[model samples]
Target: MSDDGRIATDGIAERECGEPQREPPCEFCHIAAGDEPAARLYADEQTVAFLDRQPAVTGHTLIVPRAHEGELFHLDAAATAAVFETVQTMTDALEAALEPDGFSVFYTSGPLVGTVEHAHVHLVPRFEDDSVSLALSRRRLGESDASELVSAIREYC
Candidate 1:
């Protein structure tokens, strides 16, 4: 039995995420911990899905890991899986409920790209002629540039 739209988990989220909890408490963490108000759609041991308070489009939902990882790359394998699983679930639910022509699912990793420090995935229901634009600037890189980029990224992996 759960209140506040949170799905019941059998306390499986007791495992530590290894990331130091933020001092001021991230807003998403508050939402996940049920200490803040949110239109919660779903919750599991590791993740929570809720309607975005400041939505880019109708039915905009956010899938967030219950543990506070400030960025996507900071998430460990289990948290990553749980976050994406919730993303897929929320996308399906949004598609069925809103019946939009398409959808935009995205994540911004850093403070420069993302507004909030907590890592989360945004699923926005897109309709035809919607004003929202998720488009990024297009660029064609030279062969050497592209090859160098790939090599540089692969070095870290």
Candidate 2:
């Protein structure tokens, strides 16, 4: 409700990108819709896949659901299924084109992730030098909490 979007924070930024609450205005939609310039990798009537401008690698791509749901889990069942298909297709394209050591497909949601208002999947190619593959430090998380959380997750599922 203020300049800082989070009421309480641990150094998260208030995005001044001027996007609307539940949906970004049509510029990105247009870019996603083939009306603007983007390194489009794959597209169809219901989805679009394109390279990230601030890419982790040459073929780092994002596949966005055409309907705006704002988060991955918020997507309807069919949309979720479609996003997985798109991710697989895009990842394969990136591998064949750029040939990285491996690939990581990420779906970032919630308040701290998916900075945009639309649902999207990032197809980030993992190379040996990528800073993203850094190990999680045990010091940052308590052993008990980690074990309990993993147990809770398994139980819930």
Candidate 3:
């Protein structure tokens, strides 16, 4: 963080006072800035929504912040809110347009981040028998273990 209140991520400062910075190498950044081609759906000053090129479902969409950030934790409050707001808007549009049974909303970050360094939220419209599956193994934790994990995470908060 700088004295003027810009948050830095991946050695770059986003949300600057004037024009926001974009990474030329990041395809999402170029798409958000209209430099690269994307099947754009919705766009605002803070965010841009578009169809995912490699979609998991028929109505798979991606919502990304206009500024470059590799992870959601690096985004400031305004950028965070903007990303989610666009997600909700896209979700509603997908529901009305595609009429899917449900949706799988997620984002990859940290060690699990994708090839594109820019942060993006995925809105995958799910159906009854679609081939896509997001099922993950489940594990039961003892009460003490769960409580300890909660406390450990809250310490950062």
Candidate 4:
């Protein structure tokens, strides 16, 4: 580990503050572990926030738990709360700095919907006419279909 508490993984050199010297198996884990570089915004014992490289908007950011949790379901309650707390702080900062019309906070839990396996909450700043849509087209469910879906969900709950 370097003076900044970042580990030099493989042959990747330790950086003072720029981009990561090497890519790790889990990008978010690497960033949180201080093994990879990111445009870090906030960090605590349990979580970290950083800018999204392929941002949906100017202030697009990701808040994640420092631990390597592949899905939101994998996080303990404290870890989940830590991640959201960072999300709240970053959202406020984004609003103050960018003056966006609105903002969005979302998470994808599984491989089917999530790009990264690491549990993360996306904080996307929105503006009028931004041409971004988080909307999914609505489809009416038949009574039987709705009942079946509800039953399936309730089983897990």
Candidate 5:
């Protein structure tokens, strides 16, 4: 592992904050490769679940693919399915273990919204009055604006 806590893999080193240098390995890849130490929750052939070092809540968990895929869109159908299946299992186990008021399952795809370059699903355990707020700002879109946006999105879909 590098001094910044990133695992050195494929001849690249990662920084502690998930930054890569020289096409460095992503943090998830390091963790998946067993090059870095993490509080592992579960693992299978295609996916692995582990406790987040900087957790939103006490039981925050991250689910990641075994192969290095930086973005959610980069994953194929089988990889996507495998990751979500592990997520489902983790959610069930977290509910049993923590018994929180609710839960939030989220995925961060890009640098604008996510810190890690590697694709990951976060299973955040939420209580009634938890400090974490995953809420997004609300806005009521006008009919024309909403229709336009929907149409634009549907083009890619």
Candidate 6:
């Protein structure tokens, strides 16, 4: 990858993205061949879970194996273990980070959902009032009940 966060450019640069600086997905396998964008949460090269750009709810994170997969358990036991381990860590963090009433975790595979064409787990946070609440590190929790949960959230963050 280039210092600019893209694969080193060749003459293949095109105006399809409406800006010369915007590289098309077709030009890179990571976005096209690999079937999706890079992750927001990455540890070494084992796995990543990033907030979905088109989220069902704010703080909705997508967890997946670093290796592109069409099925969940297609991964070797060790690799599968790694992805799930990160999923647990992320779940605890999201609960505290978003302070939602509760949260849910699910995954879709095969050609049916075809989510970005890769098998990925969805970490959707459920709130009591059904309003959008982001798990922003910048904002402090409000209300005594919510504030009390912050410590618990911090434990996992």
- Find the candidate with the highest TM-score and give its number: 3
Residue-level lDDT tens digits of model 3 in 1-157:
7555776566555664455554335788889989789999999999999999998878899999988788876999999999999999999999999999999999887766587888889999999989987788999999999999999999999
* TM agreement with the true structure for every prediction: 0.82, 0.69, 0.83, 0.77, 0.82, 0.57
CA displacement after TM-score superposition, residue 32 of candidate 5 (Å): 0.7
In angstroms, the error of model 4 at 119 is: 1.5
Ranking by lDDT: 3, 5, 4, 1, 2, 6
User: lDDT for each of the candidates?
Assistant: 0.82, 0.73, 0.86, 0.84, 0.86, 0.65
Error of 3 at 16 (Å): 18
Candidate 1 vs candidate 6, lDDT winner:
1
On a 0 to 1 TM-score scale, where does candidate 2 land against the true structure?
0.69
What would the per-residue lDDT of candidate 4 be over residues 1-157, giving only the tens digit for each residue?
7656666877454566744544346788788888789999989999999999999889899998887777865788988888888888998899899999989889976778888877889999999978779998899889999999999999999
Q: What is the lDDT of residue 78 in candidate 2?
A: 84
- Provide the lowest-lDDT 10-residue window in model 5: 17-26
Candidate 4 residue-pair clash tally: 0
lDDT of 5 at 108: 74
Strongest candidate by lDDT: 3
lDDT of 2 by residue, 4-93 (tens): 462323422233554332212444566665658998878876688988889877677888887767677787888788888888888777
Residue 18, candidate 3: C-alpha displacement in angstroms: 11
- The CA lDDT at 153 in model 6 is 94
Runs in model 1 lying further than 4 Å from the true structure: 1-21
- RMSD to native, candidate 4: 6.1
Q: Give the per-residue lDDT of model 5 (tens digit) for 18-119.
A: 655435446787788677899999999999899999998899999999877778668899999999999889989999999988889999767688877788
